[model samples]
Target: MSLEIRKIVSFEEETLIEGYKKADRPLRMFAVAAVVTNPWAGRFVHDLKPVVREYGPQLGELLTQRICELAGGAENIEAFGKAAVVGLNGEVEHASALIHTLHFGNFYREAVEAKSFLSFTNTRGPANAPISVPMMDKNDGGKRSHYLTLQFNIGDAPAADEIVVVLGGATGGRPHHRIGDRYQELQELGHDVDNPAAV
Candidate 1:
């Protein structure tokens, strides 16, 4: 089956830190999302593992692009912060995807080149809540899955404060057609949605 990519939920220009405070260490947070279709969901695909493995890296790249764009470009984010990736439900495995995307970082210790400086917090819950669920088997039958919400935190950065970015399916993960469809619905509802290029 064909897969659709969408921005189900997102946060834009959200200042993780209110005002600049003089401290030895400071924290910044930001949130963003890229809900991808399972491609093999509800259907049997022989190459599921490989497909997920491949798409994981692509998703990471997309997320990094969104983060950089949110920071106003590559030259803006200073290398002085920590970041986090928040998975909506099934997106927790995205951590592996991120590691794959930043594989070059092992050779070069730079966030810009890595295109990502955020760590991932693998948790399960509703996209809008802070609760979590125990890990489950990926091959369980008659089960439902949700999208992942990647969150980033920048600590002690001079150019910017704390930021939080969340990425997940707009429909909260119950086969709502495509990921971007929910985002469109939210936009039409006048929810403050931010574009990838927003600063």
Candidate 2:
């Protein structure tokens, strides 16, 4: 099924610090959102896979490209994530149907060559509802410093029978990450940190 996109929204944020001191470079985050009609709203569909499969790749490409552009370029994006919010007339599953599949997610992953799966959220909400997208290191999901969340809201969207789909990107991790890396934590524990199954 083809998605009927009503409008698009974009958000950007720059964080400079966690405490008193600020870093030389600010951490930049960007998000791209699409407001679209929900094809299966107000009813239950026994099968959702086909619907998702049909539209996933297109949505992934479109959203990813937009966010990458907003952030300067895909190569500059260090972390990534996605989210969806369904309107009151639609169920949460309607949000899930558009985002949870690799058919859509893998496109973004491959575009950025991200190793970790895209972090995500799916829920039901009304216009002006807050939307949060949690991002992880594009190459190393275990990097705690790279974990971040970008939040925003559309002033007018998801007006029942609609869904808001978002894709987020970051140019860097937290500016002043002094907590140390995950590998260092594993090392201090004196465990087989290199073994994938041992942890």
Best by lDDT: 2
Q: What lDDT score is found at residue 26 in candidate 1? A: 30
Query: Which parts of model 2 have CA positions greater than 4 angstroms off?
Result: 195-199
Q: Point out where model 1 deviates above 4 Å.
A: 1-3, 12-28, 39-48, 79-111, 114-118, 131-199
Give candidate 1's error at residue 75 in angstroms: 2.9
* TM-score of every candidate relative to the true structure: 0.40, 0.92
Worst 10 residues of 1 by lDDT: 156-165
Tens digits of per-residue lDDT, candidate 1, 111-136, equal 24433333234332333334211111
lDDT of each: 0.34, 0.88
Error of 1 at 164 (Å): 14
Among all candidates shown, the one with the greatest TM-score:
2
Report model 2's TM-score to 2 decimal places.
0.92
Per residue, candidate 2 scores C-alpha lDDT tens digits across 46-87 of: 898887887788788899889878988789999999999999
